[model samples]
Target: MTHSERWCWYSLLLMLIWLPIPLGSHRMWSWSIFEIWISCQTLLLSASLWHQFPWQKIRKFVWLLAPLSLFQCWIAIQAIPLPVEVLSIIAPDVAQVYRQVGADVGSLSYDRYATLTGLMKGIAYTLFAFNAVVLIHSVKRVKTVLYALVISGTFQSFYGVLTVLLNSHQSWFFGLPQGHRATGTFLYFNHFANYLVMCLCLGIGLIVSQLHQTESGSWHVRIRRWFSAVMSAKMMIRLCLIVMVIALIMTRSRMGNAVFFSVIACGGVIALCFYKRRPRALTALIISMMIIDTFLVGTLFGIDKVKQRIEATSIETETRDQAVQWSLDIIRDYPLTGTGLGSFYSTFPHYTHYNIGYYNYAHNDYVQFAAEAGIPAVVLLSLPILVALWFCFNVIRTRHSKTLKGTALGCLMGILAMMAQISVDFHLQAPANAVTFILILVLSGCVRQIQVRPESHPVAVDHLLLKN
Candidate 1:
């Protein structure tokens, strides 16, 4: 890697390290510790670009970013001031309701301040993703980032477990929410669980790749080699994996746990099918891991609590259904532009017929995106995800580098789990969870970039080393 690329990786490494702490410098959950890190790293990354802007570096992944760019730009557009007459067509629901009440719906965003906040967050997300794609230029760099992510996740998981063990709900950390549930450094347990889910995917992929042969045939040497592998890297990673799973179970989040194990099952199946060697061993390992972890270890960590939550969900009022209806109501009025980005917090109340306290998020990412940015936002947001997943499907189907293929498989599972969880919770609203999502996407892109190269390219590394 070039010196600039090296620096980019360093900046990225530090950014991921600092992202999980509960330091909210800005109130919107938009400007937090993670955001601050993103800003600093973006500056460093941009400086590298100013010296040598590697257009060629990003060209392969450039087309993939079109929907995201449009999505971000459209968010900024929502903040611009327009006459209420113009808005009647753009944000009909907010305007019609205001007209019915003989109140003026401001020409700017439905709530200009909120939209301004959303705009900042949208821009930050874009810059952050851009930096990731540019800086993480190789498979090795991607692996290093994943390793850092696992370590960071392990630290967060450990802290969460400790908090739950101590039962520290009395004092909120940094005035952020803390409770019996292990929230880690995030404001909510669900967000923490989602973050851990990504870590679990990476750990599983790494572990799966490790179940292979070594050539030294002496019995003592082979035993030592296996012992060293178990004692050093693989065992440590598996230990972290166990910690995260326990923390996740302690979270008592029904969808979070369900989505995670489901992803694991599916990812494992794909890995088995794609991986030509040791299919039996891989299948056995995955099944044993699931049975031992979910049914065995998880029961010790309150799996019944998760089961109760799942059961209780069926009895509760379909609140998200109502939220979706109201969101649709918003879309009908402003079919073109909707209520404006981040306006859901302020706009949803006016349309709500049921008594609910502060529906800040629709609790459904898709509904919230449509409510805030209009139906087009859904297409804009989903196109990139769909395209990325298509690439991942190809990667998982094709036989290639085990490390890269495993990385792609893990990322695919991570994205699927997030999607499943978001049906009931807004995991992506948290900067920590959102950053993890972007990181996965970036890794998939890098894996694809390398996979497309001719076989003449350097042989794929058997191990993930940071300093190659």
Candidate 2:
């Protein structure tokens, strides 16, 4: 990597740690702290990468860009000024809002302002993901990013678990509401759980990859290996995984808990299938994960509440049911042109039946995305996960190193977990979780770095995976 590239990588790490602070850098009402900071950070990195931009590297991941650009294109269509008569048919709910104010509702979308803001936020996130793909170009940097993710996630989970154990209602560090759940630095427990779930997936891969527990000789060797508390990479990853699981349990989020364990299970299966050479070690890893996760974390965190929450699921909560119904109506009325991005908070209120309270989030990302950006946006977003899965499985089958393959498979599971969790909660909407989500994507989608020989210099793959 070049000198400038090193600084850019450092900047990326700082941003990862920084995004969760200051109320999770959420509340982007009117140019909030995250908005200003993210904009500057994104632009600077984008400019630096512009000169020696990894077009070859980036184009290989065009599966991501296609849907992203399509979503933005849908946003652009929403911004255009259209004839009122035409819009009334395409976006009647939006027209109704404008008509309610005696303004030319039919001439424009009610969500134009929100669409612009949402598009800007999406752009910033994409830029940061690209930066990671460019800078994290070697095994060393890749390991650094993964460990950074695990370490930062562990710190937040530790704080969250600490606060919960003390029965505090707000953070000792940020003074943010604790809400009876382990939210850590995030505003919602689900979001904190979301962040930790990804970390846990990574931790599992790291632990498996770093595991040197091979049965070679006698029972004494095996016994010593099992009991040793060495401060090695494997041990740290294992430790981080344990704490993150415990903290996730503390969050008491039903979907969060369910999605994480399910994904972890799937990850274990992937490891066994692909890491066939390490059958014994992988089996031990799986057994250890299961024992630690169930007996230790679940037992201590009082998993009953979450279990009951999951089993007692009805049609839906009153607020969420109402929100989903209203969102559907909004989508139906504006099938072609969405009400606009970021309009869920403003538009859902008009369509609410019970007026239980204000709902900024639609609680379901799918419902909200479809309502805000139309069904096409939902389609655009959904297909990328499939593409991601394909990319991950390709790496598993093609990559030479066991660690690189495990990391890719782990990221695929993490993305799956995120998708499942997002079905019930808007965790990805949070700045911290979203940035982490993108970083994981970069890791999963990365081909060049993983394909390079490990013994080569960091920049050896600067031109890998591209045809001249």
Candidate 3:
């Protein structure tokens, strides 16, 4: 690797180490550390890789997502109106308090919590822009970074499982607290579960790719050896996957459970379709995943509150339904330009008398984005996934490397899974999820480029190539 590539790899390792720090501790210095590292990396790239920035190539992709960012910025400055019909229903005393608070604090009284969260979201978007630039400029460095992410992510899975088994509740040096929730570094169990799901997807990709390579060997003897390795890796990956699923169930997060299984199923179908040449094997893989998932769900969680929570989809609770309705009203009032970046709660009482203390966000990412940034922001934010899907389709169709092919499919499936989850919960709103999403997008982009690039020279494949 070149000097720049080496530096990038080291920087990524640091990021992985920083990722699990709890957000509430004095030692929670990972955020600033990563910010500094990324800033420096950006400077280095600007100075050395100026000519190879791939601006034209990546501009198309960036432009697809830029409108959302700009729209969010625009909405962050506007004031949204609450519907008169809804406002009429508020009790006189509550209405008086709402008006007084609104008039006194303006933005502060309305969205005290969102002030910090909105700023964080802005920072995340900036980081995402930087990540995109880095990804387009240096494919090799991006690949190395992604590989490091996979390794660290696997370790995190193990850590999460251990945390569950030990039932530990101590806070980590990074300020992350352990509790009944499965929060690693993030304070919220839901956010932690989302992060785990993404990492699990990456692990699945790595394991499957390895198995395929081992199975497709040259001679009968080699094929036998490859098959053995493939089986072993597959078993190990399944074990890890089971642990991850159990963790998700334990989180008691309805959205997380739904997303977890949905991704696995969607990913299997996609894999089967891509491997149409081996229809029987593909079918068997799908069946096996279904069977394993069903058995694991029954065995690990049993039939109880956790299982019930996972199965319960409708807003059965009145409070939750009210919150959802209030969110809808906010979106309707600010259809084009939202109240402000973090002003949803501030503006919510004007729509309904639902107690604001119980709610922080809309509990839905798309609604949150629309309510905070407006419709345009929502569209802009969704561009990456659409572009990624198109890119994955092309890569899967044209790529020769089985590893690349599986990765393309896996990344696509993972993104889709996360998107499905986002429809019900605001996982992407948190730093942990944002960080993981950006990493996945960067990795997917790199994999696509590697697969499509012309092969004029001989390839030097890794010795740790995927067997199967």
Candidate 4:
């Protein structure tokens, strides 16, 4: 690799390592700074290497998203109140802290928590887009980027296991004010678990690819030699998967568990559908068995917690309802340009008389987006997902290379899982969650490229011929 490639890889590695640092009040600020710096450096390196932007296939995608990101930034700066502001205008007593803060229109409210989160989200999106542009230029660079992700994920899995084992409860280190919740290196456990899930999926893909490569070379005299190595590697990966699964479970996050199981089921179905060409009936049977075993294990060892979670679904429902109500109120009042970004919390309390003390976010990503950046932002945000789904469907229909097919299916599953989770949780708003989402986007892009690139056909054919 060139020095630029090495630097990109190392920088990604550093960001991953820093992901779980428990940075407290400085978490958002610190991550924003790191992302901006890395993105700028990547842009410089990319410009030097290619002398122009690369990957014109998705230029439309980039252009479509830029306005929404810029609008988010504009909203954050304006911090306007929605029609809900009228409640505070009339009653004043019903207004929450944020509305009260915004009521003083003469001066901007720089003290609100939402302000900080909004700023972070804007910066994070900008950095993510820049890095994504850099990644699109070279397939090799994309692989290195994925390697960095895998390394980071492995680190997160290890850290999560250790945190659980040690029962570490402190929020942040040094003099930073501790967050009130268990965030690990973020502001919440669910966000951390979301990051882990993204890593887990990528790690699984890497391990599968490695196994496939090893097996393809061992049909003759070297069969036993390669078989042992492959089995050993598979065993190690299985152990790691177990650790990640356990950590995800221990998080007690319903959305996390839901997304995790959804990915597993979806991935398995896609694998059986497209890749299992031999003993097809047996493949179906085995897949059924695996799903049953997964459920059985969860029931036997994870029953009580599962029951508790089921019961707690009511709480989640209530929270989501209130957020939806607040979002609708904001949208109804300002249908064209709802409350500016970072202004939801500042505007939410005016619509509801009940006390929702200390809750800064809408808890549902769609609702948050609609409320913060208006309906236009929500439409733009869904573009990548829509494109990814289209690509995934094409891959399945074509039954392309097993690796590309599997990776595409995995990315599709990941996106579905995340979308399902977002209905009840604002996973996209948190830095860790946002980062994971960006990684998934890149993975989807890579899978799409693999399917379309002319070079990939020969590469797969060569491997198959060599195996035969």
Scored by TM-score, the top model is 1
For each candidate in turn, the TM-score is 0.88, 0.87, 0.76, 0.75
**Of 2 and 4, the candidate ranking higher by TM-score:** 2
| Cα-based lDDT at residue 161, candidate 4 | 53
Flag the better candidate by lDDT, 3 or 4. 3
| Model 3 Cα lDDT, one tens digit per residue, 1-468 | 357745654665566545555441112254555556567766765565566665665654464346545644554543233333333342233234456555422331135355454554555456555555454444354434545555555555556556656877664434345776555555677776777778677766655554432233246545555467567755666576666666666666666766767787887876766642322334555565567765756366642555666556555543655676678877776566555576665666677774545576677778877776668767776777777777766666666655566566667767887888777677765655677676667656666665345432111232234332
Cα lDDT tens digits for candidate 4, 1-468: 467756765666566556445441235566667667666766766755675445564464564356546655655644533343554563233344445556533212223356546765566566665565554445454444555655565555565556556655553244333332224555567776776677666655544433332223334424543456557854565556555665566566777777777777777666566553322232433354246435654554463584587686775456657757766877776554545566666677777757656556788888877776667767776887777667765664464444555455556766777888788777776665666666666656665564344334333554565568
lDDT of 2 by residue, 74-161 (tens): 7777777776666667656566666677765344346678777887777767666666766777666777777888888888888888
Alpha-carbon shift of residue 103 in model 4 (angstroms): 10
- Top-down lDDT ranking: 1, 2, 3, 4
Residue 107 lDDT, candidate 4, scale 0-100: 12
RMSD of each: 4.5, 6.2, 6.5, 6.1
Q: Is candidate 1 or candidate 2 better by TM-score?
A: 1
- Model 1 regions more than 4 Å off: 1-5, 23-26, 29-36, 88-105, 175-177, 213-225, 276-280, 316-318, 451-468
- Rate residue 248 of model 3 by lDDT: 64
Q: Model 3, poorest ten-residue lDDT window? A: 455-464
Q: Would you list the C-alpha lDDT of every candidate in the order shown?
A: 0.73, 0.73, 0.59, 0.58
Error of model 4, residue 204, in angstroms: 3.1
